[model samples]
Target chain A: QTASPAVAKPSRLGLCASCHGETGMAVMPGAPNLAGQRLDYLRQALKDYRDGRRDAPVMRAAIGPIGAAELDALARWYSAQAPAAASAP
Target chain B: QTASPAVAKPSRLGLCASCHGETGMAVMPGAPNLAGQRLDYLRQALKDYRDGRRDAPVMRAAIGPIGAAELDALARWYSAQAPAAASAP
Candidate 1:
């Protein structure tokens, strides 16, 4: 197999960029880093936050107005970024 | 506020403890550590893996037969563990 091309940065990052950073390496404390996360997991999480299945007020507010396609784009963007190294041995 | 008491370990961890560790710190490569993750996120992820909403053959096989309450207990157990430090600056 070959390496995949870089994912495009979504135009509608909105509040997601504030906490999750432009590259999805969370800029805020307590915000989970999104870089290199599973695309499906990220997609589901955004939906959960938007629809209140996740029960996080801040995340819900951040994602409330976002639609499904935009959410999928965001998930792809984040999932393509390089994740920081693991902290544990 | 008082410190929360330790969460009890679920006996039905099954293959979870093999890759995710007894304490959720991920003993296997490519597996994300689960310690100190949000309880809701962990809960949702488990359901996702089991239901095929998030596709990972290993995870699906590991969690396929697990029930809701057992999954919740597992989530609580992992969420209560101390996370390793962040790898990023």
Candidate 2:
């Protein structure tokens, strides 16, 4: 399938997937899942990171360059993905 | 002081602040704000909407009876609040 621009291009979601995993399932202790997140919620988060509302040194830098369109795509992609299986390891 | 139990009980970020307000912003138009997100990405989006793996049927019944120390006190009170400034309305 032809991935959307957000999916095809490097996006904030991609940055998130770097640690949160491609499906929003956090692979590490600190990362978190983005899969199935509310699009509105996700959008706001990206905006937060970009606008310096949220505080995450890495996240701010990560989401800094992202734009609205990309953020929307990211949100849609993650929101559509299935939530990762729960496993407390 | 004392507002800890996920901001004094009633979590899921207080039902997403009854519509993503209370700091997270997102007054309307799909609601998204959540000021200063990122507490491990809000604890994997409340464990992917309580293990359904993300799909928002009203956020899986509103995080389906949240736990995990109230989602880490609502991801450390919306990652310490702040964000919420940009307006697209």
Candidate 3:
């Protein structure tokens, strides 16, 4: 069997993968795809969700306990992922 | 009557304001608050929706006919808006 790719998942990604897939393609309707997004934008979004600057109960609950450094790491991971192709309509 | 602040609306913002408010605060559930999001990120999102890189039927239909320069203008307008305070939970 061929060896699988060794992509290390960011530890702080916690529950984000449930909706935003491991590589940042959104798995559910209404969740924005996060792959290949700007790092700073992702950082800001995480911060916003955690700090109550953006209001989304599910997001707040998921990211609330995460710290600034951890948030940055999560942002970096999602931003670095390859953007998936458009889903079949 | 008191003169309201002279915020110029971007012409290309067409149907976006119906959901993503004129100032980018989302008006409906499931629509993300876009106020103060990164200009480049917003521009990229608009392009992705228009070009089918990101698949959302509503976003695709809304932005498909818009041009690049117009999309950029809409991004600039939304990114410049003040981020709204988080809604009461």
Candidate 4:
């Protein structure tokens, strides 16, 4: 599925960019860098949000309206991005 | 803050564990493995969901009620966990 501007606009993932950065890197404290993250894992996360198996009011709301096709596009987009320099000390 | 049973229970991140596997690995298709992921990155993702920047409807809902403290705990939990075998083929 292709990510349309209306569908995949940064607004959808804008809050994500705050900590995940525009490219999925952790730009803030306590956030995990998502650049170069595995596609399988990203997809599962989207599913978890949809199923309500995971608990996070904010996450559930963000992913509430998205469909599987869009989720796939998001996973692919973030997974394909390069990871930021390892901040692990 | 410590992860309480009601607070930091797997239910909150349960859906995440599915593709992320119990250990944050990508056990399913289109998911990204989060094991061994940077703690900073995870925190950012939670924030994104809370802020509505990310486009996944499911994720926003999942992270809706989570506070920063809990988000930190979740990030630490996943980041500290070991990553499963790389499926990056």
Candidate 5:
């Protein structure tokens, strides 16, 4: 129904901003750049991390107790950005 | 030095093919299609899963004791594929 400013500008979002950089460019090695990533992929990834299907402790810690709505917001926010491909690996 | 036949044909390569589909199209709802994904991202992902940085039991069991060379091979194989979009949640 309504929008939260935090959800609107995901680049500046807390925690996620650290390793993933402001716009999902990824600030460190081993972190996948989320910009321009398919919304479905980002959703699945975050979901997997939350559900223990994927092992990312930092991610779990960073995104604690996230629900479907929040996951969607975060995924949508990151997927729309222009991902930095070269910074990967 | 020389490529293993198993490594060459990644689409049919073991458990990865089960969920990711032959061409990385994704067989299930939570699976991320790997086609056209950046090499760096793929590398970090596989590495994270193997090293326990990412908590994927199925992945860990599927890829046991994988070395850098194998990781590179898998990453290269998956990255070279033409990823399928439109499967987002």
Candidate 6:
């Protein structure tokens, strides 16, 4: 029997997984955890980053040219995630 | 009978609560959430801010003069907190 391909979880956070872990925990101190944020908040923030309302060098590069619908999808994916409980590193 | 003062939770995140929320969830887009981060990462971050290794204007001001023990305490408190689940805002 052939093994099934690993299922991809629904998320628009593809690039976000670099500094922010695949699970939404931030891998770098400079990065913020994205899990469990308010969807509206994340949406607005993304908009701001795209429009230069927020001055984040890293974010500016990361958010380059992505438009609205996908932004919403990203927000939906991240906001839907519940951050896991603290545990040993 | 005197009511006892509300007991302070153990944390060095006093100023952090202004933007990061009392619960380690960041209120601002530019600010990163701290919940569920590894303790060592958090400690190193706070130290970076304190020592000018990190260039954050707000953090530079916030981390002024705190001792090593307090930075450790802050990391401990924050890392111990599991971010609450996502819910409708």
**Candidate with maximal lDDT:** 6
lDDT of candidate 2 at residue A8, scale 0 to 100 = 44
Tens digits of per-residue lDDT for model 2, B1-89:
12233344334555677776655555666655445545665677777677765454676776676778887777667555554223333
Docking class of 6: acceptable
lDDT of 5 by residue, B40-70 (tens): 7798888878888766567778888888887
lDDT of each: 0.66, 0.59, 0.63, 0.62, 0.65, 0.67
**lDDT tens per residue, model 5, A1-89:** 12223447743267886877666666766566565566777888888788877656677688777878878878887766653323343
Q: Tens digits of per-residue lDDT for model 2 on A1-89? A: 12233344334555677776776555666655555456666777777777776556677667767777887777677655544333222
User: lDDT of model 3 at residue B23?
Assistant: 70
Q: Which regions of candidate 1 are displaced past 4 Å?
A: A1-89, B1-5, B86-89
Compose the digit string of candidate 3's lDDT tens values, residues B1-89: 11113335777665888977777666665466565555555776787778776565677777767887788778777756654333210
For model 4, state the Cα shift of residue A5 in Å: 16
Using all chains and alpha carbons, the TM-scores for the candidates as numbered come to 0.52, 0.48, 0.49, 0.48, 0.58, 0.56
Candidate 4: segments with Cα more than 4 A from true spot:
A1-11, B1-36, B40-89
lDDT of 2 at A19: 74
RMSD in Å for model 6 = 7.5
Worst 10 residues of 5 chain B by lDDT: B1-10
* Deviation of model 3 at A52, angstroms: 28
Q: Rank the candidates by DockQ, best first.
A: 6, 5, 4, 2, 1, 3
Chain A vs. native, model 4, TM-score:
0.72
lDDT of 3 by residue, A19-54 (tens): 777776666654665665556557777777777765
What is the TM-score, restricted to chain A, for candidate 1? 0.83
* Docking quality band of candidate 2, CAPRI definitions: incorrect
lDDT, residue A51, candidate 5:
80
